[model samples]
Target: MADIERHDYDVIVIGAGGAGLRAAIEARSRGLRTAVVCKSLFGKAHTVMAEGGIAASMGNVNSRDNWQVHYRDTMRGGKFLNNWRMAELHAKEAPQRVWELETYGALFDRTPEGKISQRNFGGHEYPRLAHVGDRTGLELIRTLQQKIVSLQQEDHAEHGDYEARLRVYPECTVTELLLDEGRIAGAFAYWRENGRFLRLEAPTVVLATGGIGKSFKVTSNSWEYTGDGHALALRAGANLIDMEFVQFHPTGMVYPPSVKGILVTESVRGDGGVLRDAEGRRFMFDYVPEVFKGSYADSEQEADGWYSDPDNNRRPPELLPRDEVARAINSEVKEGRGSPHGGVYLDVASRLPAEEIARRLPSMHHQFKELADVDITAESMEVGPTCHYVMGGVEVDPDTAASGVAGLFAAGEAAGGMHGSNRLGGNSLGDLLVFGKRAGAGAAEYVAGLGARPEVSQADVEAAEQRALRPFEESGSAAAQHPYALHGELQQVMNELVGIIRRGEEMSSALDELAELKDRAGHMAVFEGNRQFNPAWHLTLDVANMLLVSECVARAALRRTESRGGHTRDDHPGMDATWRRRQLVCEHRDGAVTVTERTHPPMRRDLLELFDITELRKYFTADELGEVTAEL
Candidate 1:
């Protein structure tokens, strides 16, 4: 309608991170024309920032490790609220995904026996993470990008064009998902560099955009993660499950204001680092809750012994799941046992030799040295809770990765129910590999069965263009609100009230604040400048998405009335078994975000048998257990 560039493909993928890349690879390999769009440079997706390894039950480091153990640990780590089917598939298939990466030329760190080496992480019974030092995410992204390039090379050799079947559009942002009669028809996006509108008409779409950490004041997420995919799915009429459960990673940098909230990888603890307070006391032992009591060591001697002979001793309490550890750090700071920078001390110097620390965690060593000017191999580093991951996202079919909408699918952090409430440290990478492939394959199958391809409407394209230009129209007006100021206020509201620990009253206040922010966002404007590379214009779009998704989070958090994994309530401090059986589903209706309670399907009987009845009792209601036993 407006002379916009338009292209047609079988599948359009949003967010060129680990999930997006893997999904594109799968779809292209299946002989489908795939387009990948990203908000950053081709290889600079947020996946590169991941320091921990990918979780897979390879059993190279420990013979005791297998899919069942990994599955049990994952369910336990999620406090038993996970989608059992998704967790089962992830645990069973993760090893194959990791091995498949090797076929694509990934070189993981190997054991002395010349097998892929797996390392120990929180919530897992044995060494299970396949890694490359502490920069495992970088290697995964590198491998996937290489695979995509190889495909492009093959296409060039045959068709005289490198992008014959697959192409990547970097520095582009999708502002709206166009629908045709309740099915995904296409997407409307704008190039960030030139600020030009483009339309991608496709029968199916895969959303792999990560999380919503940028909505909070302090977070480990990069600026690209503003709930883009989540907001898009909701606006396209898909339901989001567990929007209240946001993960605050236990160890983010807390010193040096500029570097605060940068992630300190869980690799530090996996490689024998410990947590201490200002008085040099190992305080994590006191924070282990009853459900995890027997699984963790009670004494320093026992914990230290486990590092050498893990078969005989329990894991150190410092290696507890992220939610528990984050809460402990929050308590220490509140009680004045914090370091000078208002955080606890994460110490590796006393536990491992300097060279060993460097060898195991090179990225962490360099990150601390350069970002905080601290030598992690010589002293303890100040660390605290920082918003990192969101366990809530688009509700999808466990096998197909299909959302409620016919042609829409989601994977990785943008899809919910895989992690339930809290994700294990290494599971995020595994999720991208496992589910990304599923979504790509699923989309291909859907495309194959389609009777007619959905068409992008000209009216919808014009509306999207008008919406993108509204900020410019509001510029220089007397009542215009600066996008930066509005964004800062939104982040402050989320970080303070609806953060790691929550209360009903605070969340109610957050809802009120979000309502006001939404009104102000309607008048948002940027500084006078050309659209090309205009940061204020970019943030104006991001702020709108953040406002919509933030309201989903606040509304769901206020409704959930229980403490479990990532969704901890201060007023209701104990995990509720009944609540475990229910899920909070968020959907946009009549121009407002509304959350409704829904019961998740029961775990399959075979999966239920993997857990001890006593362990199941901790999270399952009596009636649910009866169903489990009856089904068995």
Candidate 2:
């Protein structure tokens, strides 16, 4: 018999992303026995793929920048549908967190004045993203990994539960939630290295498993982002909020069909790049506001002038918000002014000096050379939108990061309502840090006060046990479906029907196709041996999670009629006032999914004084306005 191991912990964190690792560190510091689990290699858990910098109010580049301004910008960038409390907390805490990373030895790019360098990103009013060249994510992860590794030798005797100390398990995939009396008791998972089944018994569990980018065909996110937390929370009876707001980044490379749409970072634009048609026409100015109408210029002189006088012209050639840029690219392609790939040209070479482009965007240059065989310094990149981030996830309070399910909590991209309908390019890193700490501290506190985990019934274990073994019993090899093929089909369905723009018929048909994919998953057969390091076996599990969560997205999209933020519906072109009233919330009941609308609480009274009355009046009316926003 394969050895079954029982690992006891005060809290089990089911991811190793920036959020997950950060949570584990905090939980350990709080005297809780913590275990950080992941399904990929250490330092490569999708977080390393983040190219743009983290958004924080460091006020290094501009002394005028403050938490209040950052908060306002974040709310505005999210189209004012954000959880005001989360935005407030994130804005206030992010600067401190980023500095803490520096203390832990993260090497951020610095300004000539010796402070951390900041850059402009889509939707930010000013330079806000604190970066390290173009590979901010790598620096962040490496810094955290070093910190956690250093802490591994620390004594946990003060906690009185030494066995519950923080430990990391790489290449482990969580299979099911072990609920006791409808409360989170623990979880069961498989280790990819030895193909061993391990049981984690904990009173509190934090799901920071990141976003579900793998659900779509083209995404900037890594393969590990298969919506594991979303599926796990739904199965455990936790409610997911705002599943309809999926953000498609408007600059994925469209070539070679193999890597159909790889993400091209927004920093290229932030550093004075320009978007143009195949005929080299600057197109964004035609569709933008009158204030920004004469912004971009073909010559270097006018373009340089806009940088100094944004009020007189557009902000900058590369400083447009993602929504505006995405629509601009769409119009270009629609009007037959697109490249051979049906995408527009994103040219940074014409504006920035060659030396600066190579130094600031070395990774961009390297990737194109190795993958696409194009030199970005001399040629324009073909770009279009690809599904990148999800604004919706398991609903939780901003203060606690605790889900509706008692023992379950979430953070990072898996947690909902922080970014609302659309997240700014660099805000996600801040969201990870701010909420990751909250979830860890909260989970630790919860576990610290609780008694041992409740009983794990035989039936619960048997259900998961049966599911794991079902693939092995199939007699015919031909009947078994390959995991990659299913994943491909899922991505195609999602990209075609539920893309940046959506229609009622497309969404409805997508739902039908999702049902069929789920059915196909039931009969999937893995011809590869179910041994250690079986990438296919893990792909199978990931596909199941992706299917479950993608269905949640399609169903939620169907219920939301109006076009708001990232969830645009072609059938309903206008943003309805009713959309501002609530968010779409979903929960799995019995064997099916159920979605409902819930009130999006207003800004809390304690913080209402911070917002100027003029801005409040501009957004909300006298009757619709309220004094207190509920934390729940």
Candidate 3:
């Protein structure tokens, strides 16, 4: 008999990052019994590793910035391929979310006048991102965690309802969703500490499980980012959008194999740091033209002057949008003007006081000093692109956060449509809160009216259970593979064939490599010993998600013939107008992946008919054809 422990909750939330936690809080507020499950400790999700601030057009410092400007900047930053509704919602709700964070006891950095300080990020028309120095994510996560604890305590004392709602299950990993009939019913998972299976029965399931950065070799992402939510949604028949676009943050520490490439935080650039090649030449000015044309400055004097008067021009070098900076570094590295360490030098040491640098970037100091034995405050840090965030994920309506699948919902990096091609450095934190709330409400509302749990086949549960337990049964043989070895091979293959730049041949080869790795994974064996917190065992499952997500990426990348956003193909290097009309959505059906086209929403009639801002906002929509067709 199966060792089954069942739980019943009104709603089940997977992943305990900022998004999942926020969702749980909102669910409880709506009177639902909520349970938050995660693979790591409560505060240790990828959100804690986010170095930069949160994007919110608060206009605290720059009164010139508003949601309209924020919306335009976001659309342009995403290379005009973003879902307009999602972008609009994000721009409109982000400021209020940031304010909400403040109300929850988040202590943000204050300006001299004592208002929340805003900084410039890549692609913003005005200084807009509200930050707590470079550790904004750390602050954000800690504050949210504390608030949730407070709420749980209050709810317990006020109503004696502690046992019913707002549960946090750390170190537990969800293995499969239990779908009944055609809607979400619940999920099955196992605790990492002792390997006990736990089944949760809920009317609604929200996946805020973060990104798929672990699919690549040299990533700045944490080990927990295995595309769990994306993979789960796919198996559950949810649609995935823009899987071709993965963002590589430009300034990561590239040496020291143990830490590999740690994110160096974009705030370093926003705080007046500069990027220079080995020859000490600044090259961002050349590439900043088309994108930053009017907003950017050409000379050092002008760049420096703009820092003091950000309203007149952009602030700080290295603070440009992630895509531009990444491309510039790629170009420099390609031309052999890289630093001694094969990356460009990020020289924040020259601009800021030592005390200020240490205070603002405490994590950077700790990471470099502990891992690389380098004191960043005294020296220029060698940096380059590292896999950081996915701009593509399980596609959903931005407003509802509902997947094409009836009972599935997603938020955070797991659900795409907000950041079209490239994500700005500080925008993710605010995204988690805004969309988390929406997804929570969506899931709760769906559950409040849920009918009987759908029919779940015993065969389905058995298949998933068998797959989950396969690693424990495997034995060592000559042909037996090790998870780490297979993992390394997989990462190397993905990095080489589908990374930075792509070609049709390269993607095809990647698909073949993926096939081989997937086959080999079946023979893989976990290391002997206790299953308690066994990373190797966890990795075996992660590899499955990695392969599934990567295959989708390769398939989608091959289908898109034009270069746009973060997906650049040397063979097809320019954006195709026809390609801009629709988005490619990928779904897994009957155990095979299939692709379909989803038409972009028509330009809003109200916006199109408006006289003054029509043209400016029209760019936010896909180009117009006189007639409309349901088939994209």
Q: Which candidate has the top score in lDDT? A: 1
Tell me the spans in candidate 3 whose CA falls farther than 4 Å from its real position. 158-161, 289-291, 314-317, 455-459, 476-479, 605-632
In model 3, residue pairs whose N, Cα or C atoms come closer than 3 Å (at least 3 residues apart or on different chains), thus clashing, are: 122-320, 122-321, 180-454, 180-455, 181-454, 181-455
> Considering summed lDDT, which 10 consecutive residues are worst modelled in model 2?
289-298
**RMSD of candidate 1 to the true fold?**
1.1
Off by over 4 Å in 1: 627-632
Tens-digit per-residue lDDT, 405-472, candidate 3: 77788999999989888887677888899999999999888887766756555667677778887887
lDDT of model number 1: 0.93
Report how far off residue 188 is in candidate 2 (Å): 0.7
By lDDT, the better pick of 1 and 2 is: 1
Error of 2 at 305 (Å): 2.8
lDDT of each: 0.93, 0.82, 0.82
TM-score for each of the candidates:
0.99, 0.93, 0.94
CA-RMSD of model 2: 3.5
Q: Which number leads on TM-score?
A: 1
Tell me the tens digit of each residue's lDDT in model 2 across 15-76: 98899988888888887878888988878878887888999978787667798888877776
Q: For candidate 1, lDDT tens digit of each residue in 503-561?
A: 99999999999999999999999767977899999999999999999999999999989
1 versus 3: better TM-score goes to: 1
